[model samples]
Target: MPAAPEMPWLPAQLNALLAQQGHALLLEGPSGLGQFALAMGWAKALLCEAHALGTPLAPACGVCESCHAVQVHTHPDLLVLLPEAMQLDLGWSSADTDSASEAKRKPSQEIRVEAMRKMITFCQRTDARGRGKVVVVYPAESMNTVTANALLKTLEEPPGNSRFVLATEASHRLLPTIRSRCHSWKMAWPADAEIHAWLSAGHSTAEQVQGAMQASGGRPQNAWELLQSGFEPQAWSQLPRQLLQGQAGLLAAASPSQTIAVLQQLCHDVMAMVVGAVPRYFSQDSLKPLVAHLGAQTGETITQQLQQGGQSPRQRTLERLAQWSVDLQQAQRTSEHPFAPELMLTALLDQASQALQAKR
Candidate 1:
């Protein structure tokens, strides 16, 4: 494997930091922005015994054992801490033990105090190989208050020959103390042309890829996921029909998260179409129906309403959508109720319709 060129934005800063004896980095960006991957690459470079490049401090040699280990997720010193699953152990009927061993593993939710304890213990220990260790707390915002505090102490004093990299999509969710402890690297979204090129290289349907990219709000990685997952564009194309036709059954059959996602994408396209910035995927055929559904009157009404709504009506809408996603994820993990998806989608679509019609 060869090292890719340094990303244009913060690579220089990162490169210089790695050249230093030891330093900590807090890479922050939206989910799917590739912060975790970049952090791993940085770690590989830092641990590379034979780093090589044109500059005095160049990128890591991908051929090195350290780089290979990091790439394969087998780096002995690379400790990745994530949330644990939550489930109870069944015993003799109606006899649940209260002992620590009998305690149920908490379903994977947030990074809790227990996880922080393990990280602290690991960081405090002398490395078996006497080489530097790297700790990556990904999705760092998952840390609960207690866990955040516990982790703070370790961050304040990273162990000798160890580096701590906290990566998060929600940097604002972390404590100010935590933010101040490490050097921060913020990432930018990929350009539209760049996204298109990557999608083209993958031999994706140009229209679907373009539509997915726009639907994903220009997030290239998510656009790729939508394509690979075979997300039914028709599921979304049917949205305006369902809304205008008041086909409650259609809404009821969809997942709340998927429904809201579609509605949000529709709203985005509505705005784009109004401005005549419609991407090729949404041109003519697709835009015509969507535009008619949004109609000049309704489109202007809703767009204006959205403006007064907040700094980001889309953000609020997406948050509401995520509630459904979380509920479904939980139900699947627990195998308690499988009807959650249908219920959520119906509620979301119904709410959107009501909101749209409210001005009438």
Candidate 2:
């Protein structure tokens, strides 16, 4: 129940959720839209001593003892469910387990059934602070079949004093029974102007803010994260040209998975341009030259070839990109497995370069 990051788009949603009455709530949307933060805010407000006393419709009173407990991650009335890896990433310590056994394996990315069983016990306990108990589950899709089934039973007949909040970036992946058991709310996407203003307040330059905004598809939380991670706006803008020229060093600093993600974005935008659609991840300026170069190599403008129809070089280029997209998707599925990082990057770069140069 630690305080979530500041996301401008979440306040109104949190307020709206606070005004409602439900035993279970599901906040669903794409990543970078603040689902986890919104879920934490809801859990905090639900357990806030001030809200329990009188201000039932207000957000968490930061000065209250309950709020203080949440801020310190010692809220007896609140439980947060996340994968072990995610718990480590968020700095939340997990319950004691077989350390010797766990030390021999990588941290799990799925919410284990054992955690769900513990949560069921937590639900049955009496409230420790006179306030109702709150259970917040983030990235709820991380719950495997067994774990989700255990949760489904709780949601079906939740304890009267316990409330649940489940948040996920991919709601479609959730069990239909789970989705049907909770009141679902879609996370809001912030406007470009709103995202820009928020990032600027962090002392980011206008150029940096704009670049991050576009790179994250206007997700305010993600844009701020990108900037905080020392994202270089110029390097991103120059990525397509560098790839076209076969300069794999542009992505040498990124991990194999990160490079694959970037290449996927580039492939996506170029495919969009070939099909006469707008790009979603990269700036138009960065992709236009790459598309033009592809067109020139094929001896016709992309738009002209598309208008002429019938397996033109533009269509063939799109086909190559489509196949590359498939390959990237497969790569993403196994990205967590150990691989030679340098070899992966080189192979991915070569595939991307050849896709861009595809003809016939």
Candidate 3:
């Protein structure tokens, strides 16, 4: 998607970086912020035939021929490196792959070395258009060692006026040598107002917008996808208690990684309720019943509950929650494990509820 001129924060920051003359940029941050969109905006500005509104930091005028080519993904100078799976999911043309090998290919989850080789060759060619080239590597951590190493040489010495932007959710995974060669900028969370406006513009219900944002930990892209994926707002509100009770088969729809993430969020909120801290993921009002059900009085606050009801979580429950957190971390590390379909959701919840039970 083209950068929405209305949300100028990311583009404005990118515009400031324009004068640095950095040949490569590493846009590292958690997902949801507009890294990809901002990177494209910067690239298009570099290639645009017309500068926008006469400001040095201004974005490209969207109507020019160069801008049109980039918008249509036909820019001769733009090379995008993404996993084959991401490419297909985003509807980027797969015609770049050799036609003879198409049928035998499994959609790749990692950026393959062959694409890097093609990018290297592309860098050497004369710019088909006179304005120079842009190379975009998105979710850059998807580059396996071999694929990443292939770009190290080029990044150290980018060809001609070509510029590179590598956007990643996990920057620590990048090769240290590669990282040292580029200027790094971390993506920041967008203003809540911007997020709300973006969701509202798409005709999303308030509950859908809120539920999706909470479910996604404020990732706008994730929330947007959740809106289209038919995520039930009601299910999200009631999930904590039902999930703790091992009654939430609806949760089976989440991937293993997502399942663990939700559980972690739930665990965090429950512990937060125990200490009267605000819930981080779910709305506190929505979580009141859940907190009350966990053997806490749910008095005006956890502090009041402790004073009036003479209650504190038993030591066993605390241990169990701590252990559960550890277990979730381990699960996150091995998220690709081929867990059994029938047992995955139920088993995880069953373990959670038992851990959450009050010790007599």
Q: Give a tens-digit lDDT track for model 3, residues 221-280.
A: 777777777777888887765664557645767877778888898888777776778887
Candidate 1's TM-score reads 0.68
Candidate 3: lDDT of 347? Answer: 63
Root-mean-square deviation of each candidate, in angstroms? 8.7, 3.7, 5.7
Worst window of 10 by summed lDDT in candidate 3? 1-10
Clashing pairs in 1: 85-106, 86-105, 86-106, 86-107, 256-345
* Tens-digit lDDT string for candidate 2 (1-360): 323247787899999999998889999988888888888898888888775465456788888999999988999999999998788767776757548887677778889988898899999999999878999998899999999999999999988899999999899999999999999998888877777776787777998998888888777777777888788899999888877777764587988888888888888899988888999889888898889988887787668676767468866778888999999998887776647777887778778878887321
After best superposition, candidate 1 residue 169: deviation in angstroms? 1.2
Which of the numbered candidates is closest to the native, going by highest TM-score? 2
Error of 3 at 79 (Å): 0.7
Q: lDDT for every model?
A: 0.62, 0.84, 0.77
Residue 222 lDDT, candidate 2, scale 0-100: 72
Q: Where does candidate 2 stray beyond 4 Å?
A: 1-5, 52-55, 95-98, 300-310, 358-360
Model 1 agreement with the true structure over 147-245: per-residue lDDT tens digits = 899888887877777888888989999999999988887766766786677755555678777767755767666676677756456654564555655
List TM-scores for all candidates, in order: 0.68, 0.91, 0.80
